[model samples]
Target: MAERDDLSRGLWAVVRAMWSEIGPAGKAVLVALAMSAVVALVLGVAIPKQVERHLIDAEIRKLSRIVGAMADAGVIPTGPAQADELNALDEAVRLNLLGSDTVRVKVWLVDGTILYSDEPALVGAKYSLSEERIDAFNGINSVDIPNLSLRENEFERGFPPLRELYVPVADDSGSIEAVFEVYHLAEPIETTVGNIQQLVWASISVGIGSLAIFTASLILVYGRSIANRRRLAEKLFGELVRSQAEERTRIIGSLHDDIGQTLYRIHYGIEDLRSRVDADNPVAGELAHIGELVNEVDGSLRAELRSLQYGTGEELALGSALDELAEVTEMETNLSVSVHVETDCELSPPTRIALYRAAREAMTNVRKHSLATTVEVRVQRQGDQVRLQVLDDGVGIIDDEGLGLTTTRERLEAIGGGLKVKPDRRGGTQFSAWVPASECEVET
Candidate 1:
């Protein structure tokens, strides 16, 4: 039972993986196909058998009617035959046998004595009545398949499958006088059944085929719609990214050319004013203090502008950006952090920004959550792809790191990149990301 449960779990896991690959619409198509196949199989087996049984029933009725007609005409032998009666019996059997399309015939009395048969040796033979034969004497007509599995069917052996009909013959008073057992050539009836079966299955086959085609068309329509939607999404995302970058560039340009130059002029003007004043004058002291404040403000402004430009993917290489971030993290967290640029390659603006953000986030996580000390950031160009890794000798991440990791993943995926976080062999977390360099342009 445990093994069975394990098997079931394994199967369910496979099903789940398959479901994920195909998604909701594909799963619906798969379900529809499975149901259709089951329905077709049931109808294929059931309809043929029902039709074959109806044909056999018709044959039984025809045999019963023929025997009834012979009985009414006084053609059936009633007793031991005299010379004239025997001659009459031979004539009756000879005429009726040809019209009946039967291989053999037996007319049996109620006590199980054969009164007349087409075969001379079977005539006057007394054999025990079979249960099926007894049923016929009681007015229940029966039909059976050709293979004789019963003792009373011994005579039916050695022949290809034949239809055996046991029918009761009634007198003028409506009493069953004897049972007429007829063995007819089954090939014709079987051929008719086979033809009908073919027609039924052909119709079913056409229906199933039409269903399959319809289902396929439906899946194709849905699949194409999904593809179009995905393409539209990617186009929109790319446009948004470009729009954001342009806007950021505009802002940074304004700050640098307008606000930045204005601050520099203010600082220089204060310096010149201080230089012209006397050292002993109270006004000179005031000017010097003002100049020192202006200088400090200018320095802060330049730093802010640099950060803004980096965030906008301008004026910063990926390796230089990561190296700056590592240095800042080391100062702030008192952790040993190192950055290495192992490849000489340029990347598109979006790729650069994405990888920079991923590395920065990983470093931040290491500082905030991981308690261990040493950290290393590495960047390399591998074929058509660029790879980034942040390795730290810190206690690995716990479950509650929250939306930072999720946001980083989304950012990477938006630019056709991926991220992975795994435990390093040295008991730290390794954060890795990669993107196709071909999808990016040379970093400006």
Candidate 2:
């Protein structure tokens, strides 16, 4: 039972995967096929059976009219002279109406006696009338295949399969005088029914096939349109990321060249003034304070420049870059940080920048909002993909940290990567990111 349950689960999983891939139109096609199959089966069975029944019934009615005329004329065998008349009637029928299609003919009395039969041995034989034959005596006709298992059909073994008809012959008083039993060669009726069945099913097949082809074509066109939209979205996103990166580079260059050099000049002038001024002068103390402020601002600008320089350096592998990032996060946050690097793949500049910035922003958020004791950053490469996770044991995020997370996610997605932030089991925030490693060459 357990094995069966497991098998069932696996089967359902496969079904869900297939359904997800095929889209809504494909699902509709599946439903259409099932419905069409049922419709075809119902029509295939009912139409052919109905056609054959009508054909056999018309034959039974025609034969019954001839038998009724004979009974009204007292030509059906009730005595020796009528028996001779029945023989003469049979000769006329054989020359005119009875050919390859007629198998045998019999006239039965109301009391279940065979008054006249084409087969001489059956004449004057008393047999039990079937319930269906009794129904025929009440002025109804029935057509069916003969049941060979019945004792009455023992002599019928030498013949081919036959369709038997039981029809009533009524007199002027509306009382049934006799029952006409006609055995017909079923081949012609069966052949015609078979032909009709073939036509009906062939038309259904063509209709269903055309519908399926048309539906599939529409689905293909819809799928192509969706694919084109996705491609357009990705292209736009790529342009956005490129623009953002270029802007960051420009800002960093301005900060380092313009602001850093100006601060250095100011600090140097303050130092030269300090060397020339008296140690007890109040101006000397103010200059030293000013110099300290300048040095602090310069140090801050350098730190920001280092953070922005991720992925710009040609010598860095992704694993080594994340390791360096983890160390810096630990120094700034004063959190116990453990860094794990399991793979060494060299990524393209834009991809590496996306991953690196996402990691840096996550760590920064943890440092700013999470009042926790420890942080763990992991970087690993799996088949065709690389993953990075930053976890911090802190008070969980109670509110949304809007821009930091949203921008990080957008940047990652722009480069065909993803970011996820969730509360870990230990009530800490877990920031996870993954990107396709297939775009990167493995470092030797």
| Model 2 lDDT tens row, 1-444 | 977887785665555434433455777877887798788879888999999878887887688677766666665554333656767767755653456888777778878887766777887788899887898889888877888787667777778889888878777788887777778888899899999999999988898788778876776676566445544545665566677678888988898789988998998999999999999999999999999999898889888898776633223666677677767767776788887877766666666666777777877788788998898888887654578889888988757658978987876665446788889997889889976564444333
List candidate 1 segments past 4 Å from native: 1-34, 74-94, 97-100, 146-158, 170-177, 202-222, 252-444
Off by over 4 Å in 2: 1-120, 123-151, 164-184, 268-296, 311-444
lDDT of 1 at 124: 77
Local distance difference test scores for all models = 0.75, 0.75
The stretch of ten residues in a row with the least summed lDDT in candidate 1 is 435-444
TM-score of each: 0.51, 0.55
Q: How far is candidate 2 from the true structure (C-alpha RMSD, Å)?
A: 8.6
Q: Which candidate is the best by TM-score?
A: 2
Q: Model 2 reaches what TM-score against the true structure?
A: 0.55
